[model samples]
Structures are given as structure tokens and as C-alpha cells.
Target chain A: MNHAWNVTRMHLRYNSIWLYMPLIVLFSSFFINLIIAVLSDVPIYTGGVASVYLFMLITGLLTLRNTFSFAIGFSFRRKDYFFGTFLMVAFVSFSTTVLLALLSYVENNLTNAWGNELYFFHLPYLNDGNVVIQACVIFSLMFHLYYLGFSISSVHRRFGRYGMMILLIVSLVAGSLISAIITYFHWWQIIFTKVIAYSAFQLSWGIGLLTIFFILVSYFMLRRATS
Target chain B: MGQILEINGLTKAYKDVTSIYQMSFTLKENKIYGLLGRNGAGKTTLMHMITAQLFPTCGDVKVFGEEPYENTRVLQQICFIKESQAYPEYFQISDVFATAKSIYPNWNDGLANQLTQDFQLPLNRRIKELSRGMLSSVGIVVGLASRAPLTIFDEPYLGLDAVARGIFYDRLIEDYAEYPRTVILSTHLIDEVSQLLEHVLIIERGELLFYEDAESLRSRIYSVSGSSEVVETYMKGKEVIHVEKIGSLVTVTLLGKKEENNKKQAESLGLEYVPISLQKFVVDLTTKSREKVVKGQ
Candidate 1:
């Protein structure tokens, strides 16, 4: 257990860019929006918080190739690396969610959206529920994205780049086929209405289940991954 | 005196190509072993399997009497340094040492620091910026300072100069004598490391060719040169691994136990008998095995 934590610490030291880049993008986006609002005399609505999730997702992919291989070279078992990476990802997601929630609270209650109606953290349809529910939605979605990236990287590691390319093409064809079928049946409107019918909590729980599925897939793929 | 590693029928195959085929060996504690082989002879594959970095297609690798796959109990006792080991791009040399300190329970800070100074490794420079020789030096320092019970170096000094390589060997021998442990060094520089090896494991075309004590193996094979007729008559019914001819002179390398009677007979027969070095012996052995493989193909 101590060794696993040490591996995690080592990963955190090497990949700290993933944790800080999100905040950098967030603040940069906020300041740019603030300046635009002040100069143009107009309201700025942004969903820059999504950048944090995007960065984390990319980090998930990069770390598997970089840090995971290095850790294995250092004599860490695949299980220890998986556990350590999971701990790091979970901690980053939880902490980022809390930070985003606090910023949302301050934006909505204190600064009045930066006094120019600049909506960054408190976006509509996503933050329409209690703070805890909003945090859950963001956290689950972030985890889902991260695991999706992690699973793809694991596939690339276990199987080669050709396997990942084949997977991409297959997924694209499957998605296109599904979209074509839906379009032929004229069911896009019904799908959208059904999607909007679910509450934020229910949607988050559904995505949470998908995240678990991705996590399991990533674990199996990673188990067979070699340096 | 106890066995540190026991491998049984270990095989690794990729698609239709087998890198290692049903190899088995046992490594005793507190001894330096030389895993000598030509390129693509499965030395790295065997080391990878023992370290649990690469999985075997079939068979078992036991370290400290337990399966080493994903077992931290076994992994913590072993340190494998390869020529192609990757490092995180964001790390400095100091960060690597720090992480090694945390991972290896018996890490020696004093030794690490001393080696850092000896190797002249820049602690604050990113690993990406280091030259290839510097990178190898880092591996040597880590392998030496970690003090793991089982340390394996698979061609860990690829880009090191002769002076640096000598320093590494000297430091390795000095440290090892003070703190005895099992060490396996896999390299193609058989002559350079021949004196350092207590045991020799020679692999040819992914198969075990010989495993014996270094000193005994050195004495087992020898070459004799003389008149063609005299050498041919003397070489009758003996295992001749290699032969060379110059004009009317013939040189044949024989593989057998050294006996006083045989030496006396060769001397009395007007044949010049010369002992073959480990390097020459391995070259002869691998070349013969490769020719046999080609003939079979």
C-alpha cells in the first residue's frame, strides 16, 4: 500500500502539468471574458469549466504512455500502477469539482457573474440543480471522459497503434450507421426530447454507470499492457 | 547459497516468432552471473520475464520462491536496468534519484550521492537533455545504489566510454563485495566482463547453449595448431567446435575436460595447444549453432 502511494506521488510529481493546466485555462478564459465584457459592454456566457474536463481526459491518455511505462520500468506491477493512477485521477476529479463548485457559488451569489453577466461556471441546464447535484454531474461527466481516454490509451498499449486505428474506424462506422438509422426513421427529435426529459441527477447516475463500464474495460486492457 | 531465482520452461512467443523457447535456469544468491549471447538471442526477453515487465506465454518465473508476476513482494527485491529504459520527460535527474529512494526499500543515499558526483550527472537537468552516455550512467548509478537483493543489468552501459565502463565495473565489484547480493549482467562484451562473472549462461538462437561455472568453462575449450596431418590424427574422436587452416598448418578448437595426459600427448605430438578465451569460445559456439539453424531451415 505504501509503495502504491509512492508510485502515485511519483506520478503526481511528473504529471503535475495535468492538474495545473486546467486552472490556467480557466483563469485565462475568465480574464479574457472579463476584458471582452468590459470593452464591448456586453454579456459574456462561457462554459470554460469544460476545459478542465478536456485537459483531464487528455492527461488520462498521455500518462498511460509516459508515466505508466516509466513506473513499470521502475519495477511497479500493473496492478499497483492502475491503483495509483486511479487514486490520482479520483483525487484530481474530486478536488477540481469542489473548486469549480466554489467558483460557481461565488459567481452566482457574490460577484453576480463578474458584474457583467459573464457565465463561466454557472451554465444553464448543467447547474440548474443544487450545488451537490451540479458537482455530481460535473464529476461524473469528467470521470466518464477521463476513463474513455484511458481505455483508448490502454488499447493502444495492449494492442498496437494499428489496433487503436481499427477501433477508431469501427467506432466511427458504428456511430455513422446508428445516426443514419435514426435519421431514416426521423427519430432525432424524439431522442432529444427524451434526453432532455431526464433530470440532472438521473443523467449523472446514468453517465456514472457508463464511467464504471469504461473503468472496467480500461482495467482489463491495462492488465495486459507491457512497457 | 539459496536460490534467488528459479525459471522453468519459460517461453515467450510473438505471433509465429518465438523469442525465448522453454528456457530454464536457477540463479543462486550472492553471485555475479554473466548472461552472454548474441543479438536477438532472447537475453532481454528472459530478463524482462524475470522482472515481470513482460509476461511469458507459458511457464513460470519464481523469485524468492514465489511467482513474480504483479507480486510486490518479489518485485521490491529486484531491480532491472535496461538500455532502453524510458524516463518521464518532465523529470530531472534529481527527481529520478528521489523516486528511486522511495521505491527501493534498501536504497543507499550516500552511495547514490557519491555516484552522482562520480558520474558527473547534472541533478537539475531534465532527462531529455542528457546525452546517451549520461543516461547510461544514470542507470548504473541507480542499479548500484538501489541495493536490491536481485539486480539485473541488460546492456546497461551501451554508450559509456571505456573509462566510465571501467569505473562502473570497479564500483559494482567493490559495492557487491561489501553488500553481497545476486546480480545478473547480460551483455555482448563477454571478454570485458568475463573476469567479473562467477557463472556464465550462454544463449544461442533463443536456446540455452551452456550454463557452467566461468572458470570451468574457460578451461573446457581450447585450440591446438600444428601440421594438418598431425592435428587431424590427434583430433580423432574429439569434439572439435571450430577449425582453421593456413598453408600446411591446421588449428582446431576442442571441447572436453582438461586432462594431464591429453596435454602431455599434444605437447609430445609437436602441437601448440592454446587456451581459448570466453569471447572466442562464445563466438565459436554461437556461430556453430547458427550454422546448424540455417542448415535446418
Candidate 2:
């Protein structure tokens, strides 16, 4: 009877189209690649799963813009709304992660890339870890990207168009400034060395922390947002 | 009936404009309140403050005797439907109703179904694809069927035709009588909804002008017109609320004791009595306040 759960239901009802689309796109691309791999007799390595992660990001960006106002009109508490959105996205990420893990297993061992050497689901570095670790890495990556989008969306919700504009300009300036400084100081070598030293499992723990940060920041901003 | 809502010294100020000035009012349970005001008079701002959607610059708002902001216990018992209520872009009318059904604990599926038919809405159609009037009907259906203990509708019938508006009023009254609740309706069609309102709250330029029973509001004002000189003479030592002059033919509304003999006295003095309606009174009041603001500036 918690209205937070009701908010999750509300989101789930409208999310069907966006929900299944990434999977559909992934599978379609997989089959098409399978056809090409069979004909050419060449090893096919692809980033087809990238579409699934990017789609989650888009869903996060749309979450508040589409539903927050409507839910508030229906008398939902802000906290409940955020809680529901959180639950819904978490459910989506977990499902996506599980499916990717299963497909990766099939490509690696079960069918040997569907008998045609098509490495669509199993990327080398990403799947280097054990099955549990690989699933964790994928889940962390998808969940983190979704929350990153949600956090950005919440800024607009709380602060309006000007807020988004200011954020964009600031991000661009900061990104350029950081890139310039890093190049001038020749820091890329050190950064790359440290980054490459960490295993994918280790990297996912960092992503897990960043995902929590995005979730918290989004909730704080959306708390004061109006319809 | 207990007090369903109580607001004290509420105000919302933006960087340059004050949306609602210091305002205070207590609303009793199970009465339909008419939140009457001209456009930009802060009626919507006040309602948003009451529902805890918009934070006030300063004041207290208690719904069901508790602070409403972020309070689930208080929020779940309230339903707020507005003219520009948003829906998910991909939603159909049926999808909207399904979400509403899940959100509202007191939701009436039978009434929702009946209203969907009464409004002649194609539930399968995407909400964005519906006509403006159909969208209004969707809000009306949800507001009526929610049956929340405290329901607020801010201009709930925009773009609706006369027949559809009549159906709204009829359904509102019928549903309200069957299941009594505190309803606050803000609208510009004052005359149409005058009879439905038990109490009237008039806001002028972010300030509370009138907060009283409907009958008292009607009985407290009467209008008369004559030449500028005679009307001025009659207005001496009298509390006047509104006046209009057309080439020295003067009309003035007096705010004083309601009396049967006042009309007779006006006629005897060669002044024409203009029957004042609730709508006229509200319009005259807001116009007069606008003049006051203009003069002050």
C-alpha cells in the first residue's frame, strides 16, 4: 500500500515501449551480424551491447521530465516518487544485466559464438572476469549510466531551463580546462597506467560508488522540484 | 465538521514578483469552496501552496491537521487536478486511468468507467493525440472518481463545451452528495459555479479579499447608478466598494448592511438599482483592486 510502490507501478506501465526496445535492437543486430559472420567466415567483434547501455541512459533522462509532474498532480509525495523511480530503474538494470550474462555465456561456451565466431555479446575485457564478476560489471555500468542521466534530468526539474544551460556551459568549460591541464602536464600516462592496472571487477566498485552519488544527488534536487 | 485545511500568513515571493501575499484562511470539511480571483491574482499559487507542491515564502499550511509537504499520510488523502496537468507522452487514456486507479486508495473504478463513456473518450487513443476538450474530460474523470477526502481542481474544465461543462457540474454535485468531501475549485466561470459553491474565497493581487459563506457574500453588496453628483451625494459617509462612470452617469456598489429598504430608498432618490450577481461582484472587486494598484504605483 506504499504509494512509493504505486509510483513504481505507474512508471512501469508507461515504460513498456522504452523498456523492451533496447533488447529488441540488440537481438536484431545480433542476428544480422550472425548472417554476415556466416557468409564471410570472419571473426565478428562488435559493440552491439552498447545500444542497451545508451538506452538506459536515455530512459533516465526522460524519467523526471515525463512522470514527476504527473505523479505530483496525483498527490504523490516527492520522496515516494523518487523511491519508485529508483526501484523501477534498478529492476530494469538487473534484468538487462542477467540477460547479457546469459548471452555472453552462450557465445563463449554453449554455441561457440552461435557456430560462426560472432563475438556480439562477449566483449574481451568485459567478460575476462568470472560469470558473477562479469554480471556485476555490466550491472554497475548500466545502473551507473542510468542514474547519471537521472541526475542530469533532476537538475532541469529543480532549476528549469536556465539551470540546464548553466550546467552545460560549466561542464564544457571544466572538461576543456581539465583536458588542457592534463595534456600540458603529461598526466595521461599516469592516469592510463593506474586505470589499466585495475581489474574490471575493481573498476566496477568505483562505478558502484559513483552510481550511489548520482542517485543521492538526484533525490536531493528533485525533492524541491515543482510540477 | 472539523477544519480540513488551515493556512496562516502564507506568502510566495519570486525574485521580482510576489505571487501570493500574506494570506490566511481556514476551510471546514465537506464544503465546496470557490477560490475566485482574476488571472494572476495568485489563486493557483495559493492552491499549490495548500497542496504543498509549491513552497511558500513564509506561512503555515496544515491539511488534515498536519504539515502537508512531503508528508505521505496527508498527501495520499488529497487530489489536485489542474488545467495543465501533464501526462506521460506515450500514455493512452486507459493508461492514465490505470495509473490513477493504482495511486488513489479511494478510487472508484465504476465511476471512472462511467465517466469514460459519458465523456465519449477513446481509451485506446494516446493522450497527446486527444483533443483539448478530451484532455480536460480526462482530468475531470480522474478528479471526480478519485474521491479523495480533500480534492482541489484549478480550472478543471478548460476547452470544454457548455454541455460538457454542465455534465461536469452535474457529476460533481451528484458524486459529492453521495460521498461528501472537502472540495476547492478555482475557476473564471464564477456565475456558472456560484450555486455549487458553499463558501467563497476571493483573492486579489495575492491578498485575501473575501473569506465567508456564499449567502453572506451576496447579501453584503448592492449596486445603484445615477448622475455623478447625486451618486456622490448618496455615497457620503457610506462604505463603497466599486464605481463606474459613463459620461457622468455614475454606478456604484455599496458594501454595507443588506436591507430590503435600500433598493426602495435608492429608487426614491432617483438612483437606478442594478441587481448585483456573485460574478459581477467578483469582477467589480478585482477591477477596483487593479485601479488601486495602478494608482499606488
Candidate 3:
């Protein structure tokens, strides 16, 4: 196959960098908390809002689906297209993950020396290092698959505006339905439906399953797009 | 002369609306051929089919004796410059050059860079951010520098100012002279490229109207100008393709041999026989053919 890496490289240089905004905002929020601890003589390990930072991680990845789809040759082989996008996302994620870890490490040490009991969550402790890593990996892939597939299906057609509107409506409806289903269904007897709704494990599973389903659905829709 | 491109009964229809119908034409190597038609006359459609960007609904298109669709050997030897070439929002002018250099094996980077400077295209500016004229310049530069055996320019000079367009035409002719190849220029700017065209292909409403040498086309239709009454009387029992009336002056485009009798009759009636510009002749021919179709329908 005639690979156009130069073209792909330019695409990532400009668009892929935007995908890291969530990590940037997350690190900035942490840095702010660290600064406050420094001024108040409090420890850096003290907990802050986990939900805001996690939400940033999820939405940032989701929003990037459009840019990734646009940049990569999604019209070509689906495997290669998805692989290219996954590689870029993985690279960005790894870089940001390392950066955040270092920042947290320095803050934790500073606060510990000051004798303030500050609590910092390392990525490895997000819930069994392997589990969180698996969750993040699966979550990123699934989220990307679903968003890319849905957008490619609906964008650029005679009823493109209507298609996009319908896609948005369907995605929102699907997301709510999943949330509602999880709200009703208990998992493993130990975790209640509401508890699963609040837990990161369920979030990772939901995203992974949804992404796999989306990939299958998108391949079908792509026949129409490419036809 | 060896046949560089052969399009056999090429038919392209979208949803039963035929854009090109059973069109067959062969382009000889080292000749500049003009693909002429009014807008929606299927000129661009034929070009697209030839370039393998659009597959023909029926018939075949061959470049260098092979199918062009996904046949890299054929495609590599062909450069298709669309009127508005779409690029990603992030792709800079230099990115286009970089991609073209790889895509077209015959791509001359030195020439491409030179054209960039001549066209005054900012190498770092994204393609989407460029002005319409600049975008066209970038396309022209690629089309020319690619130096493909089968080069096609489908109205590639749109939105370019007259001076810049002149530069393009001059550079194209100069380069083409130094290195001859099969060049198919599809444009509404017929008069501008008339001198450069060795042959002409006229399409009228999805059908190939005429395909002949440009010299023969000029000889095929001769304009007879005189008083309306006298010219109309002389034009009887003759094939008059187009008739233009300006006040009392009647210019009848006669499509037959310029016999001595017809000339004498025109001379006796104080008429003048003027050579029709290739552009005007082609416009009249296609327009007249279209009028006949409309009248028949």
C-alpha cells in the first residue's frame, strides 16, 4: 500500500495536539491545588474533585473523534485507519500520563516534607494499576470508535444537517438509555445499580462495549458513505 | 501516432440522469486536446471518469493501454488538476507540495518550488486559508510540475486574475514545448487556449458533438457576414449552424465547403467572409446543437 505518512504527520502535528487539552486542564487544576497547599501550609495529598478531572479525560477524548476522523484516511481500510488514530491517541495519552505523574510526584514530596497530610492519587492507584490501565485503554478505544463511526455515518450527505442532528439525538438517547439501564441493573451482587453508575469500572466497561458496537455499525454505514 | 488515452463508449449517469452518454474518443500522444463544452455539458464528468475519480456507468477508459481505476501505473502517469482541489484544513501549501512529490513519481520538486515562488504562494499557509486565486495557482503548479504523460486540467484556473492566468498559459505552453505529452484541457476559456490546442473535442448534452483537428474545425465552420435579408437568402439550402444578428448585420456560421458560387453571391450582395475564432466557432456549434435538441424535445 502507498502510505502517505508525511500527510498524516502534518495532520497530527496540528490536530492531535488539541486532543491533550483535557490533560492540560487536569494538570493545571492539580497545580492550582498544589499552590494553595503551599500558601496555606496544607499537604498536597489532600483530595480534590475527582469527578471534574475524570469528566475532562472522557469528554476530551470524545471531542477529538471528529478531528481524528477528519485527519486519518478513514475512507481507506478501516483497520489501518483505526490503528492510525489509536496510535496517535495512545502516544498523547502516554505523554500526558507521564507528565501528570511527575507533577504529582514533585507536589507530593514537597507537601510530605512540610509535614502536611496531602493525598495525591497516582495513576497506578486509580484502582489496581492494571485495572485502570485496562479501563483507560479500552475506554479510549471504545469512545473513539463510537464517536468516529457515528460522525462519519451522519456527516456529509444530502441530509447531512439532519443526519448530524439525528446522530446527536441518537447518541444522547443511547447514553441516557445506558445510564438508565445501569441504574436498574445491579452488578456482581456487591455493587448496586447506582453504585455501578458512580464507579469508574462500569464507566470503562460501558465505553468499551459501546465502542465495539459502534465499530460494527460504522462499517455497515461506511459502505453507504463509500458507495 | 501512438494512442496515449482511449475512452471507448464511456457513459456516466447519476440516478438515471446521463451526464455523459456513449462517448468514444482517442487522444494521440504529444498532442494538446481541448475538451470543450458549456457548463453541465459533461466535459468535467468525462474528465473525472478518465481520471478514475468517477467510474463510468458503462464503457471503458484506458490510459497507456490499461484501466485507470486503482491501477497505480496508469494513475501515476496521469495528473488531474480539478478546479477546486480539496485538502484538509490543517494541510499547508508546503504539505500539498510534499504530498504531490510523493504521489506523482514524475513530480519535479525544483519546478514545483519555482512555481510556488512565481505564483507567490506562502508555503506555510494552510490550503484552506488561501484565497481562491492562490488555491488555483497551487493546483496549476502541481498539474504542470507533475509532468505526467497524461495531464488533465479541468477548469483549474478559476478565480485567477487575468495576469496570473496569462502567466499560467505562458508557462504551460513553454514547458509543454520543452517536453511534449498528452494534455487534455477542459475549460470555458476557449479563445485563450485555442492556439495551444492541436485537437478539439466538443460535447453537447452528454454526446460527443465533434472530435477533429483544431485546423479542420476552423475550416469546418466559416462565418459569412452581410445584411440580414441578403445573407438569409444566400444561406437557404445550406447548413447554417449558428446565426447571430446585430441590428441589420447578419453573421451566419455556414458549416460546409466555402464554394466559389457562395462566395460570389456573398460578394455580389456586398457581404464579407470573416474567419471565426475557434472559441466563437465552438460556442456557436454547441449552442446551435443544444437549441436543436430543445426544439426537438
RMSD of each: 1.7, 1.6, 5.5
Expressed as tens digits, the lDDT of each residue in B50-165 for candidate 3 is 76656688999988999866565776688888874566566788876766676677788888888888899999997778889999998899889989888999998889989899
Give interface RMSD (Å), model 1. Answer: 1.0
Rank the candidate models, highest TM-score first: 2, 1, 3
Sorted into a CAPRI-style docking class, model 3 comes out as incorrect
DockQ, candidate no. 3: 0.15
Model 2 TM-score? 0.97
lDDT of 1 by residue, B133-194 (tens): 99999999999999999999999998899999998999999999999999999988888999
For each candidate, what TM-score against the reference? Answer: 0.96, 0.97, 0.75
Single out the weakest 10-residue window by summed lDDT for candidate 3 chain A: A68-77
Q: Residue B283 error for model 3, in Å?
A: 2.3
- TM-score of the second chain in each model? 0.96, 0.96, 0.94
- Proportion of native contacts present in model 2: 0.83
Candidate order (DockQ): 1, 2, 3
* Colliding pairs, model 3: A45-A118, A45-A119, A46-A118, A46-A119
